[model samples]
Structure formats: C-alpha cells, structure tokens
Target: MEKEIKKVNDEISVAAFDPEENSFKSFAEKGFKSVINLQTDEEEQNVSPEKEEALAKDNDLEYRHIGVSEDKLSEALVDNFRQELENLPKPIVVHCKSGKRSGALVMMHIGCDKDMSGEEVIKQAEDMGFECDVPELEQFLKKYVNEH
Candidate 1:
C-alpha cells in the first residue's frame, strides 16, 4: 500500500491490488480506519467484495464499496465517491486491480476539489506513478478535470 496524506482533508492509501485476508488485519494493526474499494463485482480478483467487507468489519474497520469500471467512471461516480469519502472514517485505504484506478480517482478528486487544472492532475498522476492507460479513464479524466 502507498500512503499519502493531503492537506485538503483525507489521509488516503492506495493499494497495488485487492487486499488479502492477512492484509485486512495488517491495515487494522497499522491504524487504518476505513477501506474504500473501487472495483466492480464483474472484475473478479482474489477475494469477493462481500468477503472483503466481512474481513474489514471483522477487523473493526469501516468498509465501503464503490463499483468503478470502464463504463462506470463518471462525474457522478466520482461525486458519489466524494460523498462516501466525506462520511467514511479518515486514514482510508482505497484499492482496485492495479492501483491505477484508485490513484486516478483520488487525484481527480483532489484536482476538482482544489480547482487544479487537468494538466496539473495529469502531471501529478505521472509523478505519483498512476497510469491512465485505459482509453476510457484517460478520456474521462481529461474531460472532467477540465470541465469541473
């Protein structure tokens, strides 16, 4: 997991992939308060979201799921994610398949929230090693950050 705290409001950690069973306990032990999963159910990985949620709860961590896929990455989805972020406990760990999606979303949120430009968002994403290789996300980020 990659840890970074923003002055804006949240302490977010982006995971390289879906959290494993042991990872949940580790997160709890490490003082992470919440889990925000950005994967859709259709993209099956190591563990199911339901099981992941159970594991998080068992570890006494808040768990929230927002299914973001190629077709699902939109301003509305990001808005919903922001709303969830507002209500979720701080020091949140967000994850997707390769961490790219999670990073992109978080950076986009920062960009829009702070009124940063699309270029700035893209540059920061590159600096943070986030890849918006997926055409859909690339296009959406370019459009959304500039528009909002």
Candidate 2:
C-alpha cells in the first residue's frame, strides 16, 4: 500500500512507511527537518530502521527511532516520546505501521503538554485522520493527566 502523509498540525505529520528517497527530498524541500519512527524493528513488513535512517541522514533530515511495541506501551514511553518531540527540530514526521502508534503518541504528547482532556485529544487525532482508541494507551493518558 502507498503510504499517506497526514499532517497533524503546522509542525507535525504522521504516516506509515518510511519515506523513500524522492519522498524524503520532497519532505526536505517542504521544510520538514526530522522524522520519528514508532514501529519496532521486528514488526512485520516494516522498513529496516538502519536503511531508513541512512536515507534520512543522507537527505539531511534527522532520524530518530523510538520503537514502541503494543505490549510495551506505558506512561514512561509517552514521556520520552514527548521529550523527543520537543527536543527534535521541526517540522517532524512520526510514523508507525499504520500511523496508529504515531498518532497515539502524538495525542499523548498534546494531552500532557497542552493539558487537554482525553476526549479533546481523541477528537483532535480523529480530525487529523488518525483514530486513537488503544485501551492501554488511553488508560495511560488518563492516569498521566490525573497524576500530573
């Protein structure tokens, strides 16, 4: 399937596959400075992290692999993801197998950083063409808001 890039906001976008060479060039030309991959290396049909990273670097885009698996999703991971999102240069592209994890992580970052409610975050994600409905992820987000 051809990967689609859905812009989440002015500074961030989400997609599935790692951009190929031409795609990377287009992103660079369009001013995207970095990419964050949320899929684990072992995921079926995933692009090799090493190859994708090399291509991104060759095209002058900073590449970060965060590798979040379904079973390992947690508040700490969300925190680190947010830190990376804040630390990385924008505009950034975050991607997973189907953009689900990427979108969820972005939602968590927005919920925590902007103090948005879970419903608000879900609505925002849906508006961006990403459905955020992972129960574990949602629970973690709720607990995080309650704690902090």
Candidate 3:
C-alpha cells in the first residue's frame, strides 16, 4: 500500500504521493474539495486531465491541473499558479510525482502567502528536494510581498 504524506492546516491540506489512477475514488471518500497537480507534459509525465476531471466530478472535488517544474519554475508559470492559489478554496491538496514540485510550489506560495523571504522559501524547497537552478526565484520572492 502506498502512503500519502499529509500536511493539514486550516488553509490547506496537502498530500504527497502518486495518486492512483483510481485515487479519485479515495478522494471522494476523503471529502477533499480540490486538487492542484504539478506534473507537466514537458517532462512527458502527463496524467490524464480528462480522467482526473471525471474522477473529480464523481468525487465532487474541484480539480485544477497546473504544471510545475522543479528545476525551473518560470515567472509566468509561477504567477499563473499564484493566481490559482488565490482562487482555490481553502484546504486544497497540491501534488506531483515525488512531492518535489508540490513542495516548490508550496514554497513559492509561502513566500507570497506568509511574507517569507526568498532564502527562507528556498530553504523550505531544499528541505523537500527542489534545487533552485535560477536566480529568478529570489527576485520573485522579493516582489511577492509587495504585490500579491
């Protein structure tokens, strides 16, 4: 049996694991309201969005598929995900293959969500296995607090 790492809070409920293709069944049972997927087609690791939607519909959970990369999270993409974060209902689950992308996105959001510094957010990402391959993330962090 595969185990999902659970991060519970009033604002979010994240799970890190490869959601079974049938995991939708479990999601329904668990009463999750939303899902944020971080996998990307650029890496050839695309999951079926149609299937995911079907499962979400069956389970009554709102699902959003956003592709987040570990090595390089583009400014535009980060902004897009940031917007999604703002739109998502609380207690959402964000996930990727090994939780790395999920962690990075979560860190990015934290930098904005909690007013954390880039180094602080990077440390958070490092704690999960995401390496910062570019300097843009630091700049993004600086701007996050001032703007969104």
Candidate 4:
C-alpha cells in the first residue's frame, strides 16, 4: 500500500504500483485476497510477471495478469475480464501503470453488472479518483453498455 489506493467500493481498489514482496504481505494483512494486473509485460514500469506471481503466492494472495491495451479493447475482452472479476476472490486490488486501464475495466464491469448508464458509470469512477480519459476506452464502454 505504498502507493495511493483508490477504493472503488468495499470490495475493490485500484492503484499504480505492483506491490513489492513486503507490500504483498501488507495487502494480505489488510484483507486483500487477490491482485489483478492490467498492464502487459512490455509496458513501462511493469514488474516482471514472474516476480508478481511469485510474490502473490508467497503472500497467499491469488494473482492474475490480464493485459488490456487501449487500442485492442473489445467487448469480448471486457466480458472475459468481467467474468474473471466475478470469479476471483475479493477484496481485490487491480493495478496498471497509472490505474487508468484498471479503472476503465472496473468501470465497465460495474456498468454492465448493475445495468447502469455509461454516464453514471463514468461519474462513479471519477468520484473514486479514476479518470476515464482514454477515448478508445470510453467509446468501447459506451458501445458495450448499449449492446449488452
């Protein structure tokens, strides 16, 4: 929890740093059961996936890395991410370079899960400190909500 942790709800949080080994233990001590990473291996500032997975195991936290690039976001990807979010044990911590990608996915999941309007979802995310500034992500979310 060295970085700022933005709680989206009681069950979920988003942050920028991939917790280090000690921080993983802190996360478990703080009641986080899972860590979901949205950045790809190639992303700048990302820790190696091997290290992240191992640390989660050492700390008794489930770890999942599902990379989502802005240019490549699709309904199928978001649907898959939503399913994973539903299945993963919580309270969960999701992170990317700056939390934007994680926020986008979480916002989309909330919108789809609660049958909320896209505007409502965006406002909720903004209130939680996750700015949805990526236009591709915004467009995808709007389309996803309309179709689903």
lDDT of every predicted structure (CA atoms)? 0.81, 0.78, 0.67, 0.81
Scored against the true structure, residue 66 in model 1 reaches a CA lDDT of 91
Q: Which residue pairs clash in candidate 2? A: none
Model 4 misplaced stretches (Cα beyond 4 Å): none
For candidate 4, what is the lDDT? 0.81
TM-score of 1: 0.89
- Which scores better on TM-score, 3 or 4? 4
Q: Tens-digit lDDT track for model 2 on 1-148?
A: 6558888778788875555556667767778899888878787643577877887888899989888987987778878888889999999989887788888888777776788877777777778777666777767656665555
lDDT of 1 by residue, 16-37 (tens): 6766787888889878899889
Order the candidate numbers by TM-score, best to worst.
4, 1, 2, 3
Clashes of 4: 0
Candidate 3's residue-wise lDDT over 1-148, tens digit each? 6557556345555566667667776765666678887777555443566667677777778888886654556668878877777787666777777675676566767777777776677776666555555465445554553455
Question: Could you estimate the TM-score for every candidate?
Answer: 0.89, 0.86, 0.74, 0.91
